[model samples]
Target chain A: MSMLPRRVEFHEEGPREGFQMEKGTYPLDDRLALIDALAASGLRQVQCASFVSPRAVPQMADSPELFARLRKRPGTRYTGLWLNESGFERARACDNIDIDGKVVFYVTEPFSQRNNNCSVAENRERQLAWIDRYIALGIPFEQAYVVTAFGCNLGGPVPVSAVTDVVRWLVDACADRRIRFPAFYLADTMGWANPEEIKRRIGAVRELVPQARIGLHLHDTRGVGGANVYAAMQMGVDLFDSSVAGLGGCPFAGHKHGGAAGNICTEDMAFMCEEMGVDTGLDLEQLVEAARLAERIIGRPLNGRLMRSGTLAAMRC
Target chain B: MSMLPRRVEFHEEGPREGFQMEKGTYPLDDRLALIDALAASGLRQVQCASFVSPRAVPQMADSPELFARLRKRPGTRYTGLWLNESGFERARACDNIDIDGKVVFYVTEPFSQRNNNCSVAENRERQLAWIDRYIALGIPFEQAYVVTAFGCNLGGPVPVSAVTDVVRWLVDACADRRIRFPAFYLADTMGWANPEEIKRRIGAVRELVPQARIGLHLHDTRGVGGANVYAAMQMGVDLFDSSVAGLGGCPFAGHKHGGAAGNICTEDMAFMCEEMGVDTGLDLEQLVEAARLAERIIGRPLNGRLMRSGTLAAMRC
Candidate 1:
């Protein structure tokens, strides 16, 4: 068997990424209810919302209000996504939310411009400039999100060297400022990566940052999402980002942008792990219930298969 | 990276298996049209229909008529499924249908009785009695299918020894009879398999039948269908049975009986193989078109993801 970790950490991104892709904005109470249900499902971390512009992503306009209403579960981490200074300020002002203060950099120039309205070079310069203010707000600028780390929509293949260079730069900057980063995420933003590409890129990232935990945010766009996860597990990657019921997509890119389907289904991922003897510290049944609730809240069938089929454990029971 | 095969053979079983699961019996002309489209999409082999009892499976009652009207594609192999002597005789009467004379022995007794209406020992005895007759008719008994090789709905956990014993019996019987059996398939009829289970079972089968090619016929009951494929591929097992649009379930067990979701989707499987540089020699776009046609014919949406999300290759193009 390929080498694998005995345990995996699945961080739920449904309340944030899954909701943001919806064409209709769910009621605030409904959204809060879904998050509470997810928290009860034994997930250690939940990405609650993104504090982006309401004009850009209307679905996330209520992030501050939602954060205030969030009943934070003990021993559970609740984080909010922040892209700009305004978003970070709003996140910092929230009562029950934790901010990652991640400086996002796209691996390709076209995706950086198309998705973020900035070039790769300009985004890097801007992020470096914001480090002092972000640090002053008691937010750590240690970790980074290498968006399109595998490939991009406009430019097909994002070079492995480019991703590693960004990681190395982050490491050097952190060392210069004496900041510690626990982990970094390689986001397959467009869901274009294969197992070979995953191995290549994850290997490169590990070589650059030997001490930091590596995570993968995979998409099921091409139907290889689970296969890609298996390959990453074989490579000893234990951190994954998934959304309930397989919800989420890029608003700028649209549903079909870069063939993005949704984030890997959280229930599906947890099912895979539990079946393979990898403890995820989750209740599969509760996750399935949460997924069903998510479907009701969204008023559409989610992309996940386990909800329809049921788990083997459940069947045996 | 884990060791993998350079090429994989994906046999399309959608028309046969996918259609049989639907509540609606698709018109013969529509079934023929979907099969023709699938053949044109570069799939080398397609299982067109099963010649089962009309009373048992009404959806497959038109097997004879469908086989008669099929537009045979040059260089493509078309096969039919048979369970008893009558079904085998019907397949032989057809012009283009190929029969495996597969003598099935379920790993668990309850599944054998529930699915095939015969106990494991009785089925084995009956199949052994028909071997001479099957060979005399020039229908090679070259392969067998071990139904519920992974687990059974009624019997729960099937032992690894039960599966290997069956394979060893086949190997010995074939060697004694001077017959060359090319392969045997391990069917996860209930889809109760994980990567670990796949590794364990496929490893045991290989150790016993050193020269025989091993194949996996996986279902998507618990959503690890793609993950199971990846695990098998890492173990150097490449042959898979997939239905277009992921349409299939054991009618005897029903959709919820054994946690049956559907078959491993053909388009989704082809997409995964293509993304990982494993050649399946199939046009994904044509497969997607076939899936759409299937959905229309069935008057319901199929379970495939690639149809909704499109392929990464198409996205790149």
Candidate 2:
């Protein structure tokens, strides 16, 4: 109980994650509306778009237009994701998007090849080059993402040692360049993590990088996402990456059975945190409204519980 | 970690809970097929029907016939829910249904009046009468359920003391009759419980009855159902009542907003337990099949995750 954080931070990734996986084209206006709604909901960070190829992700092809038109909230940090130098350059070109340097490494080579179209060594070299460019441009590093940190659908179960090894590598990479590693985000890219696995993996990462600010990017694909969030919070890991209305699914995850579910829902996670006496710094009603907006934009019922059932505060009133 | 249970018992409430809430009539064959599938899935206890009025719950009108035609599996305990003497008599008339005497008390008056069609006192008197009848018949007592034990939609937040008072009353009532009080099941009837609330309320209950086994009947209405389950498990509370394919919303919970979600999904919960090394004595594959069958019967996508994403073991294979 003592280990639970009194406050937690959530990064909204619905615009980037959700739309990218959706089947049809949504108007740029609808996307912007959802993003603005999320920013107004008091989320400190909002990943509004991804600078990926239109051919790869047709929905995110309007990334530059989204950034150009987005009404940026003063307190909220608007961010975008990019996987390579070309994507990074595209993100750098956006005036409204916050250009924070971040690096990514895959825990499994199979996922790395499938998602990034590169070998593990090739991806690392690309990341290192980006790190050098960031240093040269005086851009402060945001975090290092360890994708498939828990387990991979293509690569099977991930060992705690494998997670620790990734963290250790990222730490040493930053140390060698005299740059302090800002944070480490462990991503359950394929929704393979359970609550126990979450605790074990986080503990293992902490053991390797004792002072690193650890965060989670968990998928609710398997339905234990809320449990996983609670487990992480119990360990005082306050940072999380979530989607509004649980918008996105992993396009890379084997969707032959059904498409993978999205990240732990934002309003649902925020509602849980606030209910448990953890300060989420977000408005529940506003988040719910945003979730509803997301649902309307998607033109379907997204996998979010709080959006459907609402908050306890609303119920009490 | 040491407080976590090595094994947990799940009472399948899908057939009884799901059908009673669904709108439209389902064929007797479809209902029996689901119940039979659940029984064959290694579930020890399956609540197959509710012997309630056809006017109130048209879906459960076939409960008696359901019991008569159900293929009774040797190891499974086929059960039915009955609120009053008439319903009890209907259940007693069924040759195949297992009859274990159970009592219920409401934590709040408004919900008591609304759901049970009586005040708390009147409901208690009815339960007492049923208890006497059970004793006369030499029927074994199962457990007592504390409805809206966490909070109520109409009655607002329920205090910890309110729950313990009901438990204390039930304990004393049984003691006065010289019958030992069976287990206490704290039900989050309207999905009002958060993880912290679960821990706090369970702790309060344990203080009053340290020797008694405690169980949870949690709703995933607000999305913290999985988290609440984890919190209870950490306290070594092993018994749970879950719905297959996340079936059955509370018809009583205000549906003016979107209707309340169903119970914490059985396959999802079981998947979490199994992945965390908690023995459930149920087959994951069989449960997935059952969940799909539930979706097909309902003619809609049920709110279950494992049924879509699949188990980690399947991914490993």
Candidate 2 residue lDDT tens string, B1-317: 32589999899999989988887789999988998888888999999989888899889888888898988998899999998789999999998989988988887889888888899889888888888889999997768899889888889988888888888888888889998888899999888888988888888889888988999999998789999999999988999999998998754455654667899899999999998999999999999899989989988778888888888886686
Which pairs, if any, clash in model 2?
A: none
| Backbone clashes in model 1, listed as residue pairs | B18-B247
User: lDDT (0-100) at residue A237 of candidate 2?
Assistant: 98
Off-target runs (Cα >4 Å) in candidate 2 are: A250-257, B250-254
DockQ of each: 0.52, 0.70
Candidate with top lDDT is 2
What's the true lDDT of residue A134 in model 2?
A: 93
Alpha carbon RMSD to native, model 2: 1.6
Would you list the C-alpha lDDT of every candidate in the order shown?
0.82, 0.87
* Candidate 1 C-alpha lDDT tens digits along B232-316: 9888888998999888854335444222567899998888788778898888899988988887887655677777766656446
| Candidate 1 regions with alpha-carbon error over 4 angstroms | A249-260, A314-317, B249-260, B314-317
Q: Cα lDDT for residue B174, model 2? A: 80
